[model samples]
Each structure stands twice: as structure tokens, then as C-alpha cells.
Target: MTWNILVGGQDRLDAIASVIRREQPDVLALQELKGWSARRARDFAGQVGMHAHLAPSVFGQPVAVLSRRAPARTRSITWRLHHAAAVATVGGLTVVSTHLNPFDPERRRREATWLSACFFRTRQKVLIAGDLNSLDPGTDHSEAVKRIAPRYQRRHLRPDGSVDTRAIQAMAAAGFVDVGRGIGPTVPTEGLRQDEFGDFRLDYLMASPPLAKLARYVSVRRDEVTDMASDHYPVVASFG
Candidate 1:
């Protein structure tokens, strides 16, 4: 599961915990973990009955990965990203919790490319999940994106007034497959919709071709707790 829990879920920790406890995904990738200390993240992991790793970030927007088993290794990746990404090696799979620049498409492009190529030294199956802040190809979010008030749309579009897609394209070129593509949009939960944001997919769970082929199912989890817990919803992808 991958979710951008707004501002570290400070005010809604219980609600967030409730949703997580109910879903019970084997692995969780989280973004926008603002004000999160390693201790705080560990405590949250304990609360959820999972082992956790918090990738420390200079900007306070750290990404995290929590899993059923303790990871063998954990590392931080900050290659031109607005937020630090967390990597955990669990079993034979390498999981990456990533968050790209929320505003700059060019920076997001660079970040995506770097992340896509990072773990290729080994033939390890890789699963990347979190708020990529970009849309995949073959999905038309233009209508919803355009509804987000002109001034607030620059970051989501090119100067040509079209949705900018270079960031995601870069990742695809590196051989990453969108495991949850066409599942659904992942943002602007029921109570959080505003003029500045509309329904669209900004979060994802991507896998290397080897891992992608084993994916069994993908879903977007939404309900009362999710609506109030964060502006962005959670997504889950299953594999054999």
C-alpha cells in the first residue's frame, strides 16, 4: 500500500492507524511524512504491528516503508528529490518508498529516472511505491486537471496548457511498470476537494518487469476514515 498521509497524520493518527489496521497490506509505502522522527515512525510501526524505516529528509517530508518483517537493509535516496525516499530490502524484493518534487516537472523527471535505474546493479525484483506526483501514460486526467483553477494548474501542466507527462515517461523508459495503472485516481479524498486540487492520480506502485508480471491485483481503498485521515487516499497492489 502507498499513501501520502497529510503532514505526518499528526492530527489524525488514530484514524490513519484504523485504516491501516483494517487494510493490513503486507507492505506500506508512505509519503509526506512531515515532522516524523525515526522514533516516531518506529512507534507508529509498533502500533501497526510492522517493522519500519524512516528516510531522514532535510525538508522534513520524509518517505517511509513498513513491512510485516524487519527489513535486512534500509537506505535513503535523495537524488534531486524534494523529499527523501526510503528503500528497504525485504526477502528477495527491494521496496522503494518515493516522493517526487510536487511542483517542478523537470526535477520530478530527473528523480524518476534516477530511482528507476538505482537498484539495477542486481537482478533483484524491485517494487516502488508512493506519491510520484506524476501521471502515467494512456490515462486522460486532463479534464480533472484543468478544473483545478488556472493559477494553481501551472505545476500540473506544461506552458502549452497541456498536462506535462515527461516525468512518468522517464520512469517507463527505464523499464518500470505501473502496477496500479488504470485502477483509479488517488487524490482529493471526499472532504478534501478544493479549487486548487481535483481528482487525479499522483501516487503509484511501480515494479520492475520481473515483479510486475506477478502482480495479482490492485485497489484504491476509500471510505469514511480515509476521507478524514488525509487528502490523498491509499492504494494497494498484490503479488504472488
Candidate 2:
């Protein structure tokens, strides 16, 4: 019943593969995926002895799920904002891997509402994890991301990358609790690069209160395998 989840940006099959080998996560959720190749995703799942559910469509590229056990049911659906959700199962638990819109707050909020409805309707245990391209604690930009000058920093937020507190709030309101607080920032990819720690906990793993009780550990890092692959750190959450 224990599992690991990885969330990051694209072109990271190698890094992801490495994590799959090392963590042996019973379930994995990835953002920024491409291709219609079931072989590639299935190959990775095969390497880890898991089955994968993939959607190579829209924003942040795509979203995927690799589970050690095949889900009882699987479905893919897209919200108005290009955000996608992969609903799967591990025993009696229902898991959804999703990444919300990054720039447009309204779209993100709208999508959150849709997601909330799904949660209310599901009767099984649940877990939701992904990039969300979101930030908590405030609606303003990081001083560093801001100080880079609007011209340079704007690249940091693009095509709907805006702070949506309501999105986070909605998840909370839906009874999902973030496992990132006090654990440290899971962003900026690298931990030793800047003054102090420039990481912010943007990526997340949330579960229903009952499911949270099953979580054994939640760790954030941009270590060797993850750092070399992408610009965002991987958030790994384990639940039994």
C-alpha cells in the first residue's frame, strides 16, 4: 500500500527512470510528458514492474501515471484550461495525477472546482499529486524571481502561470492537505546554487485525511538523479 510520486518538468525520462529504479514507487505521476508511445511509458513501467496510464495532451506537455498494480478503473479527462487528470486505483484507493494551469488564475480556479466535484463523488480512498506550477504562502512573486527584472522574470511565468490562492484553497476546502509545509521548498531544482535555499514548495502531494494517515514519509530533493534531468525538484511522497 506504500507508494512514491515524482513531479517535474519535461525531457526527463532518464531522471524519472532512475527514480523509478531507486524509489520503486508503487505509483508515479509526471508532468511535461510527450509522445503517444505506450512502449516508452510501458517500458518504464515494465522496468519497475508497474502499469502506466498516460495522456500526452495539452499544457505542461502531458501527465502520466505508473502504478505497481493496475488500477481497477482508469479514465482521462481535460478541464477547460488544458489541465489533465489521470484517475487510477491501487487496491481500494482512487488516485488522480494532475497539474493545474500555471498562468491563468481564473482557469486554474475553474479547473479546481471541477476537480473538487470529482473528489466529492468518489467513494474510495484518494491521493492527488502534481506540478500545478503553483506557489503557496502568498500571491506575489519571489523576490529573486521578481528582481531578475520583468523582461527576464516574465519567462518564469508564461501562458497562464499566475498565482492562484483559490486553487490551493479549493483543494484544502475539498479536504486535501498538502504534505510539503516545513519540509522545505521543492522548486528551483537545485539546492546549493543560490544564497540560502531558494527552493519553494510549489509541487505537491495531497490526500484525504484518512489517506494522509497512511503516508509514512514525504521528502523533497534536487539530488543527483533529479537535478541533472530538469529545473524542478522532485517531490516524493510515500504512503502505506
Candidate 3:
């Protein structure tokens, strides 16, 4: 599972815990963990019945991975990224939780390439999930997209002024399959940042070919609990 949790869920930990308890995912990747400290993370993990592995902060906001079992190994990617990518090896699978630069596509493009070189191309059993904040080539143009400010929209435009999808396009070219591809939109739950993005599928769970093949299903959470928890919805993937 992966979710942005909207600026640390605006202090709504109980609602967040409620959703996680109901879903019972083996592992959950979380982004936008603003104002979180090691002690807070440990306490939250205890509340959710999981073990946490954290990343270094970018302006006090980091990313994290919570799993049912302890990680065998862990690492972080902080260079050239908005929020550090939290990595953990648990149950023999390498899990990467990341949140890319939401305001810059060129940087996102570079981040995507760098991430591919480091992880996707290795043919390892890996799961990369989080708020990519980059649109795919074939997704629909929603009504919400038109509401964004022209300046912010300009950031996502290609040189020719079309919507630039190069970031995610680069990842697919580097050999990762978007495991959450056909799943519904994962953003704009409630109280979303109006100037940022449309109601699109910005969050993702990209898996290596082998791991993707083993994935049985994927789901996006909606409804009362999710809306109460964050501005973006939670996405879950299952492999047997």
C-alpha cells in the first residue's frame, strides 16, 4: 500500500489508524510525513501494529515504510529529490517509498531516470510505491485539471506546451510496470491543494516484471474513513 497522508494527516492519526487496521496490508508506504520524529514514528507504528523504517528529512518531511515484520536491511535516497526515498528489505522484497518533486517535472524526469538506474534495471524483487505527482501518458484529462492556475500548469507542460509525461514514461522504459495502472484515481480525497494537481492517478505502485507478474490485485481506498484521514486516498497492492 502507498499513500501521501496529506501533510501528516493534519493530526488525524486515529482515522489513519482506522483505515490501516481495516485494510491490514503486509506493507504500507507513506509520503508527506511532515513534523514526524523518530519517537512519533515509533509510537505510530505501535498503534498500527507495524515496524517502521524512516528516511532523512527534507524540510522536516520524510517518507516511511511500515511493515508487519522488521526489515532485514534499509537505506535512503536523499540526493536530488524533494523528499527522501525510504527503502527497506522485508520478507525478501526490496520496498521503496518515495515522493517526487510536485512542482518540477524536469527534476522529476531526472529523479525518475536516476531511480531507474539504481533500482528498476537491476531485475531484483522490488516494490516502488508512493506519490509520484507525475501523470502518465494515457490517463484522462479531468475537469479538475482545468481549475489549476496557469503558472503551475506551465510547469507540467512540454516545450511544445502539451502535458509532459516524460517522468513516468522514463520509468516504464527502464523496465518497471505500473502495478496500479488500471486502478482508479488516487488523489483529491478532500481538502486537496487546489493549485497543485487535478483529480488524477498521481500515486503509484511500480513493480519489477517478476514481482508484477505475481501481483494478484490492486485497490484504492475511498469513502468516509479515507476522506477523514488525508487529502489523497490510499492505494494497496497484493501479491501471493
Candidate 4:
């Protein structure tokens, strides 16, 4: 499962933890964990009976992964990258949790390029899931974006007048299938009052072929617990 809990909202961590407990996901990819230190993440994981790996956040919004099993290897990848990302190898699968820059598509492309290259280098099955911030241009969400934030339409469009799909495309070219495809909008339109983007599929769970085959199903959780938990809904993917 992947979720972007609001930054510095430790007061709401219990609400987020409630949802996590109910879902009981094998692994959790969390982003926008601002003010969360390694010790805090570890303590949260321990409370939930999971092992955690937290990436140091240069922008105060760290990414982290919590798993039922201990990871064979874990680290933070932020060298030459716009935002920090957390990586962990658990049960032969490489899981990455990240949050991309919302204001710059060019920077997002660079981050995606680096991520794709790293995904290719890893021999194990891989799953990259988080708040990408870039939407698939081919998919139509312009009306929604305009409705929520008319100003963002101009900023979100590329210099060539195209929507920023480079990040997702890069991952696709690297052989990752966006499991979030066909799934309903991951962000709630009602939450647009808090954030700029409208009901778009900004969060995703992209998996390599091997990992994709293992995935039994994928969905965006929108229960009462999730609806009030955060601006972005949690995306859950079950594997066999």
C-alpha cells in the first residue's frame, strides 16, 4: 500500500495508523512524512509490529517503507535527485517510496530518469509506488484540474504545450506497469480546497513484469477512515 500522509501531522498519525491496521498490508510506502526522524519512523513501525526504513528528507518531507518482514538491504537515494526516496529489499522484491516535486515537471523527469535506471539495475522484482505529482497526459484530467485550480493548468503544462507525462512514461519504458491504471481517482475532489490538484491519479504503484504477475489486484481506498485521514487516498495492491 502507498499513502502520502500530510507533512508534520503527527497529531493525526493515530488516524493513519488505524487505517493501516485495518488494511494489514504486507508493505507500506509512505511519503510526505515531514518532521519524521529515523527514530520516529522506527517507533511507529514497532507499534505496528513492522520493520521500517526511512529516507532522510532534504525538504523535510521524507519517504519511508514499513514491512512485515525485515529488509535484506535498505537505504535512502537522494544524490543528484530533487527529492529523497526510500528503498528496501524484502522477500526478494525491491520497494521504493517517493514524493516528486509538484511545481516542476522538468525536475520530475530527471528524478524519473534516475529511478528508472536504478530499477533496471536491481535484479529482484521491483515495485515503485508513491505520489509522483505528474499525471499521464494521454489520460484526460484537464477539465478536473481547471475546475479545481485554473492557475495550475498553465503551470502544469510543459513548454511545448503538453501535459507532463514524462515521469510515468520513463517508468513504462523501463518495463514497469502502472497498476493504478483503470483504478479510480486516487485523490478526492473535495480535498482540493486544501491542495491545488483535483481528483487525479497522482499516486501509483508501478511494478516490474515479475512483480506485476504477482499482483492479484489494485485499488484506491476511500473509506471513511481514509477520506478523513489525508488529502491523498491510500492505494492498495495485493500480491499472491
Better model by TM-score: candidate 2 vs candidate 4? 4
Q: Pick the candidate with the highest TM-score.
A: 1
TM-scores, one per candidate: 0.95, 0.80, 0.94, 0.93
Which candidate do you rate higher for lDDT, 1 or 4?
1
Best by lDDT: 1
Query: Tens-digit lDDT track for model 1 on 34-134?
Result: 88888999999999999999997875498899999999999987546789889999988889998888887777888888888775433558988888888
RMSD for all candidates, in order, please: 1.4, 4.7, 1.8, 1.8
**Model 4 C-alpha lDDT per residue in residues 107-181, reported as the tens digit of each score:** 888888788888754345899989888787458765676666656775466787666688888888888888768
Error of 4 at 145 (Å): 2.4
Candidate 3 per-residue lDDT over residues 1-240, each given as its tens digit: 898887876668788888899999889999998887767777898898999987867543689999999999989777778788999999769999999878778888898888877887455688889988888877755344556777778656777767777888888999898888778778777644355666678898888887988999998988877876887899988897
Q: Give the lDDT of residue 44 in candidate 2.
A: 66
| Stretches > 4 Å off in candidate 2 | 1-12, 58-60, 121-123, 138-145, 148-164, 191-198
Worst 10 residues of 1 by lDDT: 115-124
Q: Is candidate 1 or candidate 3 better by TM-score?
A: 1
* Candidate no. 1 TM-score: 0.95
> lDDT score, residue 70, model 1?
92
Clashes in predicted model 1 = 0
Candidate 3: residue pairs that collide: none
The residue-level lDDT of candidate 2 at 13 comes to 62
lDDT of each: 0.84, 0.64, 0.82, 0.81
